[model samples]
Target chain A: MGHIVEKVQEYLERIERSSINAYIHVDRERVLKEAENLEKNEKLKKRPLYGKVIAVKSNINVKGYLVSCASKTLENYISPYDATVIKRIKSQGGLIIGMTNMDEFACGSSGETSYYGPTKNPRAEDRIPGGSSSGSAAAVSAHLCDMALGSDTGGSIRNPASHCGVVGFKPSYGVVSRQGLCDLAMSFDQIGPLTGSARDALLLTNIIKGRDFSDSTTVDTPEFKVWDEEEMKNFKIGVIKEFMEVSDERIRERVERAIEVFRDLNWEVVELSYRYIDLALPTYYLINYVEFFSATRRYDGRRYGYPIEEVCGEEVLRRIMIGRHISKKEYSGKYYKRALQARRMMKREMLKLFKDVDAIVSPTVPKLPHKIGEKLTPMEMYAYDVLTVPANLCGMCAGVVRCGEINGIPVGLQIMGKPFEDEKVLNIMIGFEENF
Target chain B: MVDREKVEREAEEIVKRFSQILEKYTFEEAEEYYILEIKNVLREDEEPSVDPSFREEVLKIAPKTRDGYIVVEKSRWE
Candidate 1:
């Protein structure tokens, strides 16, 4: 226990010196007191995640901490209670280290949209850490925390994980309770884990997942099954053509090499295509606009820190305005309803494809993360999520693992499975990670 | 005293943006799509007990409070 406290202190020291801007808030005295309390408890060794330091994305509540969602709208707002996931982690002996930075209201693909500052990619300091779970991925990559919780509403977890060269898992929708998470898109969001390895991600996911009375969307999921070191032979992996075609040539090559690694292990690699895959990004963003607008109506300056429209960052404002416009009774059917139809079509297509293949694989992003302040249009930033949004659109479980590095920058290989097949996705990720 | 022309311009702009979004997904017009995944998970309608001090705790964080009530701007009608 003494050594664990010392290690945590050391990590805190490193965080103080770090320039990545990964954390929006850290309460040193409170963290040390919690660690000291754990040390005094003799039964600490019996608990899972004992002495593990877990960073939380700012959108997820940790009692008494700022759950700002990296926005000025909630800058001074303190969480009155812990999110269900935070409670689960703490109960399992995990220490809540700090709140990590993210895109304001989880609206951007790049980390630059954070009100705190952009979370620089630890792998490449100049490049943006892909977001909206930017700091969680960056902190794990820099070894500032053992694990972190991040919410994925259309690739928030996996995108940053891809850029930072760590493992991130977005469990099937409703697999993990979203009780205290600040919603991005309620229908698309799921709280997930990002860690240095798939095994750690799985361990954390198991602790946090299950039904919660506070979140009615949560379903009764089976107890998480640990994966045996099974051989990769005979597993059918589908290579999504749409993902490859949109990806940069270097990224595509790296992903192809990763697929070849699976092929070399005697697994069947099948090249497959979903015809309407290009429609995923537009559908995903449309849904995000509507849901985010609804979620933000609560921050009208009376209850929260400030009025959202008055203080939110540019990207956040853009989504809110668009969301309000689209949700108008006269225009709802034209944009919002049409997007929902496309979403259903995507889910149907994915379910049909899963019947033929055990899992789908692709490069996590279409292009490498650009320089931290690189000038990119909103549309260009949206394009970065082209390859990662389909999983969320279809309500499937997906995991991203570092596949290869191009010019010292990491590329992530995404593996996705049908709903409630989270364990299978993690297992496949574990197999690929070990082989790589 | 309705500004008919101004209202018409705003309406046209909204429709233009909506059309652009629809075109992005290759949808000429909105189509009815059933949400197949939703289930009505209704729980028993019973009021659960809450801690007496919960109100005090919540009020402590409100931006403006007076006499145990959250204060808000008065309505224009009022």
Candidate 2:
């Protein structure tokens, strides 16, 4: 345990931890205590993530540990039980370094509105790390831990991962149980990994994911075949036209270059249109508002102790208000139902689209990171999630790969596959990395 | 006059929705605070929107209207 603590401390200094503020708290005492046993007294457990040090997003419960959702309301509250993912990670020998910071209630696309303060991009501290999984993204970029776990509810995880120039994966919904997730649009939320490499990502996901009884929504992945060197010869890939059109010209160019790499690998690009993706954000926010209004009743100041209404930051408050207005009596189904129908329509369209392409590839975020603490015009920040949110809304397995650099900061290419075909999507990614 | 109770009910639903996005609040309290705040907004708001017809609409919904707006019984908060 002491050895792990020393190693974690060494990583802290090496990563220049002071600048990023990725973690809300690092539980050195628990981690080190566990590490001591693993080193001298503990027997080797046949765990894939054994001896690996990973961080958890503040949203996930860590059992008797503080799991602040980066809000002052949750600041003093400690989790009484482990979230399913946290339990799996610990059982598999992955050590929890600490809970990483995030946007209050995972409301914003950019990491700026965290009550604990925004986490800066380790690649470029001057810029905002895309969020609400801002701290998880920065932690890997800084190598503070091997990788971190983050929740993606409308692109929170992938947006940050892309801006930070690291790999982020959002498994098909229900693949990773939501048993312990601090519900953010529960239907849209999924626990996923943010790692330095696709290899590490696969290792962590395989451990934490599976059908758990605790999460009634979870189901098993079907017999998905992995693409071996031989099978890679004839698989087709699709590029959503609207998604490829970057809001920034340079990001568009970067994506084109990454596309060329696929061309070099003899992969065919299937041009397709997913116009419904354009409505993804509005629909998402609508559904989120309705669902969030329903979900938050558990925190009535009496049971949860803190009043989220008083302590939660502005972004959260805005969503609450927006959701409130949309949920009026006659308007009940007007916004929320329409959004769900849109989600259904998009998912149905993509189901057909995925039939033709082995995976869909696009730039994760259309732009790179913006300056830290910079007041972003709301629309501008919202654009960061444009490329990623559609997948969440559509219930697809999506991942981001660091493709190239823009002014020394890394940009990522997003690859999404059919629902429940997370393994298929990841295998293709791993195959691409083998070529690299 | 707009009943604060109606607004409170709406606010409860709003807080309930906000809780979904955040899940920070438990189900009961979120519902309570939400409803109460909405009632408060109704109570304090002389007018809710900037639309020109808002005053007219209030008068139409209310028991009476004088001039361009609802002619409600005066209250301490108002």
Candidate 3:
């Protein structure tokens, strides 16, 4: 009991003196009150997440806390209710530490888009924390919280996890509920965890994943195959040829080093190619623009804090305008519809490739994190998500683990598995952690 | 309107590149495939259950509220 109280106080003090800008809100009074109550209750002490401090990304709803989405449009608004995941976490006695900063509306790949300020990578102080889920990953990396909740729309979770050198898992789409999460692209949005280790991610995932009456997209949890040392020897791993072609040589060397870990264990490693991989970025962005524009229409200065169009950052405005153009009655079939077709093709291509391999391995990001406030074109920024978005496009489970370092900066190796094969992906990550 | 024009120019460049890449593959004229197969989950028809306090919490977050309801300006047509 004393241990939990001491830990919470320690984190709160560190947060006060820190300049990473990882957290946007931390109520010292409420956090201590919750910790004290947990100390008093013997029954709560038996729960799995008892007294574990969790940092939540600002976009997710936590009752009475700000769910600002890192945008001025909802800056002053407090969450009216708990998200389904938050409810589940609380039921297991997990303490909500505070809401962390993020790329405003989860729209940018770099952490610099937040209205609050950019989150500096704790691991590499001058570099950007790869984002959308920037603060969640940085908080875990900095030891400000035990574990954190992050949402992945298109590589948001995995990208930052790579840059910040932590474990990030995007569960198979629809396995986790999205009832109270603010939408980025409804079809692709998934709430996941960024943690210090793979096992912690698995523990938190099992707690929050199941059928939810409120989120119609929720599905029954799938049965996971427990791993045996001898049985794992037979697993076949694939390295995507297209992903490697675009990666910086330094990142590729780190990926190859990770592949060597699998080979040394008598696991088969092969190269597989999917032709439509080049189309992933355009397809992903076209759909996201349309859906994000649709979702922002509700913020018209009536119900929410202010009008999004008037208050959002540049990237958010660009997506809205692009979406508006594509959605015109005459432009429909030319852009959005073709992107949907390309999406279907990408999914089919992946399903076919998965039949030959248990999982695919690659560098999580093609390049290392750049310095904060670096000048980059929109297309250049979009390239950071190229390797990670394919997993989301195909509705597959993917996770990132710190494999090695390049120039003293951490590099992540991404493991992607077939849909509903989240356990296998985590098992591969765990195996990598043990051996490397 | 100037911002819109710049946005349009940027959109054109992006669209042109995307179209070129998409043209490399031949797509079938089939219905778009959805990832999940489940249809909408319908609730049983019964008298609605409401939490009265929820309304108050919702109204509290609104930019404008009056007399226990959210307030909005009249539309341009009105």
Candidate 4:
């Protein structure tokens, strides 16, 4: 009967009518009750996220909710406790709307690999909504929620955010606690926001970030600052030559057009070449395969859901198998160790490059989203992460904001900032969003 | 069912792709790099009290469970 409840009801109705398959679970009664309580709870209204509804990526635990990770491996698994991020959100009065669909165990790039089925792009109905944070991005794009939480292990957040025409951010590693996330890779995974605007992303980031005792990887970084209009100008944007060349022509044009906004503001746009960038995918996937294999060994079916190898989708199985092979003692140095060295080199390269430029700019994804259910080879799917993986590899902050559309489907311009300079990446995004 | 042979073939191709990169680049021996300096934070020795309801929740999700205990297969060691 209250306005808050009425508004939430409208969203729930839209979700019910939506064919996007963005959410895997929505406890309608619980959500409405929370909204109703928000109307009466005066103290809660004073909190930062009082009226905001959040959709969580299935990999992150929400107490008493099914945390399926979009895989049959834990299809019926209920979370016994809230993840640290969820605790923070609740403490700030953020209402969790539902669990969103994703690439099974956050393994796929195209969102179609979920056991529940792919999340349809709300912006481009027939095409894939990029993943493994598929539903979080789609939910925001479709107006199903004010914002969503997504786990980014090599662009899971920004990839889908770009495809769905929303803002998705991957905070610098160790900036946000990864405590309750069913991690894809411990070394790479970060939980971040998918929202309609850069400011909203910042608001969510501020709430979720900081040190937590439960997650030893967490760091108490300096608070992020909101940039003034004048502060956004006179910065250099480094356009990686490889990122541009690897993109489709139309996407390249859109990205070029997006860069002109910075140029118009008198920001110098420089071309920076990193030849080894071509190896980004293989290096990322090689590390990913090994870590994912190690992480999934816990789901042996006796304690949780089905054994992962028995019920997981093809992509998950592929990563597991490759991870197993590379982790073998005989092959360790040849593959996984080599990839680790490459990662270190890439990290050093990023540090050197950032010395000259404030942020690196590129198209968020190399190509536009392919049609849903279109069969892409494993290599082809992995190639989608080429531009975004470097940030994770080097532990840099990155964000995607829609700059323009290619044939009515949105194209995102990715801005990556130095590690812990998340505010700078966000401010640049905010600057572009304001000027665009 | 997972096709082991197909996965192996795919794995070989992927490994070959990266192997070429590794072969092309040479690096001096360097220590492993982690994002942060991690240390084992020790706490005061104490027994962790288990909550009964929380224990029940854990048992509930187990595919196989006995009275208040998760039932896992016995090891094959002699």
The numbered model that scores best in DockQ is: 4
lDDT of 4: 0.90
DockQ of each: 0.24, 0.02, 0.50, 0.54
Candidate of highest lDDT: 4
Candidate 2, position A108, lDDT? 84
Instruction: Give the TM-score (vs. native) of candidate 4.
Output: 0.96
- Candidate 4 wrongly placed segments (more than 4 Å): B1-4, B29-33, B42-52, B76-78
How much of the true A–B contact set does each candidate keep?
0.26, 0.00, 0.42, 0.45
- Candidate 3 RMSD computed on C-alpha atoms after optimal superposition onto the true structure: 2.0
- lDDT (tens digit, per residue) of candidate 1 on A69-107: 999888888888788999899888899999999999898
lDDT of 3 by residue, A62-89 (tens): 9889999999989988988889999999
Q: How many angstroms is residue A27 displaced in model 1 relative to the true structure, after the best TM-score fit?
A: 0.4
Give per-model CA RMSD: 4.0, 14.5, 2.0, 1.9
lDDT of 2 by residue, A226-330 (tens): 456786776788988888765578887887787777787887977988866556556566777777877765554443436576666666666666666777887
Give model 4's docking category: medium
Pairs that clash in candidate 4: none
Model 3 docking grade: medium
- Worst ten in a row by lDDT for model 1 chain B: B27-36
Backbone collisions counted per model:
0, 25, 0, 0
